[model samples]
Target: MMKNECSVVQDVLPLYLENMVSEGTTVFVKEHLENCSDCAAEFERLKSGRQIDEAAPQREHDTDVITAVKKKIAKKIFKIVAVVCLVFAVLFCAVLFYTGISYPVTKESISLSTKTDSEYTYIILETKAGKSLFFESKTEDILNDHNEVCGRRIVLYNVQYHNSFTKNTSSMSWGKPLNDEKPYLEVIVELENDTLQISNAE
Candidate 1:
């Protein structure tokens, strides 16, 4: 090789000693080193001279290329595993929702609950067949008793449902003090088939 070729080869020699050249370049270096004892002895000198870490090469990270290749493989494998797990989770959720069963993230409650004697509430359930599914009950209207509590309209149906068959203010227990003694109408619901229920009405 020419002096410039030898110099380029010498510049990459530290990397060669640590097995860090690209395969094509390594082959080129091997061909040159076999014919040139000067380069070969330089190679041997560098190998025996110092610990690999202490010998800072012209470049940093003697094995950066190989380490980067390994990292790419590991990252590809992790992405595949993550996509597979996400697919399984989505399938599981879809199955649960279609079959009306609870999956990992499915809420166990369809019923919302709160307490107060301040407002009246009601829900009108209509079927896909366009039929009203509930009976309107003859309950005493409780909206007449709504009063400002602490300077706000104390909404009750958020606590009480309006279609209650009867209204009782005293029978209601809120685990807290209510301003009213009459049983407030709050309905707890449980569902069966296409039919729905209103429970705990007082």
Candidate 2:
């Protein structure tokens, strides 16, 4: 009879520890535990085990909180890195745009001269120190009222650019073979705000 009672009490111990048993069942289990040493010891062990079981969910909750914090920190770091890279990319493109475009040079910034030999006439062009020049020349047909070509016009211009990588130079010269048959009727220098007529046949 005592052994059977012990089995019944032990089976009910879990429910009793969790306070799920009815009032009558609670009274019976307490009475048995007080009288029986073995059942009392079993109840103590179950109580300790129940405490740990209840604490497990709290520990799991703490771990989840830690993981969530780590993920947020990682996302913030990624955003900072992406923003830094975008800034550098914009600066690089700005530098390229500044260096790539060309503009007509002001007349006050350059000196133009001419040197002649038997075969050719050299147009000597010079820029200020630390600047570079881009020279261009073209010829246009001079027309009369009837639209007939009377002569040719020679146009000359210079554009300038400066950067750290460009060679530091002050002067450049170009020579052209003179055509005796169609002697240059006029030579015009195109400046930023004005035109210079260097030579005119008329």
Candidate 3:
């Protein structure tokens, strides 16, 4: 009878190896395999076969995880490169705008002229390059006050260059009488030496 039981256990060993046996059957098979060498060897053979099937899917799962991680790293790298390129493009455009809109001019290359309109007096500056800048003053007294720079030079605050529908234009108004809200170029002038100095305000 025990030999017949060993044969029955061997027939169901494959299901036990695959973990498809009921709990009671699993307990019975484990007890029989422990006592009988023949059934134990048969169980080892079936277990080895099932392990091959199990290992293949595990390897496939590992491969999928690796592929997913690689894709995530690739997406992050692409985003970083795109952001760096965008920043570089913006800085390049700003440099181009600065070069196109603003240039250096000395007092020798510029002449000042005054014109009277319906509301105010316009102080017009003509450059040797035929570029012009204008400033408005309510009275000649305001203009005289701004022009008084140690009796030797005139200091113009916030001299701005414009490059839009009208090209090669600049402007500055007297600060005390009326203030003009516009961007300014970073250039300082010394009338005594007739020099123009360029600087970065930032």
Q: Pick the candidate with the highest TM-score.
A: 2
TM per model?
A: 0.25, 0.48, 0.40
Q: lDDT per prediction? A: 0.51, 0.76, 0.58
User: Model 1: how far is 155 from its true place, Å?
Assistant: 99
RMSD of each candidate? 16.1, 8.9, 12.1
Worst 10 residues of 3 by lDDT: 174-183
Candidate number with the higher lDDT (2 or 3): 2
Model 1 C-alpha lDDT per residue in residues 58-137, reported as the tens digit of each score: 23565786789899999999999999999999998876664443222111323334443445333322222211123223
1-202 in candidate 3: lDDT tens per residue? 9999998998888788778899999999999988999889887887788788889999999999999999999999999999999999998898678545744445665555444445443444454433443322221121234453211123443333333333444444211111222212223344434645432212
Q: Which stretches of candidate 2 lie over 4 Å from their true place?
A: 102-160, 164-202
Query: Per-residue error at 146 for model 3, in Å?
Result: 54
Task: Write down the lDDT that model 3 would get.
Answer: 0.58
| Candidate 1 residue runs with Cα over 4 Å from true position | 51-202
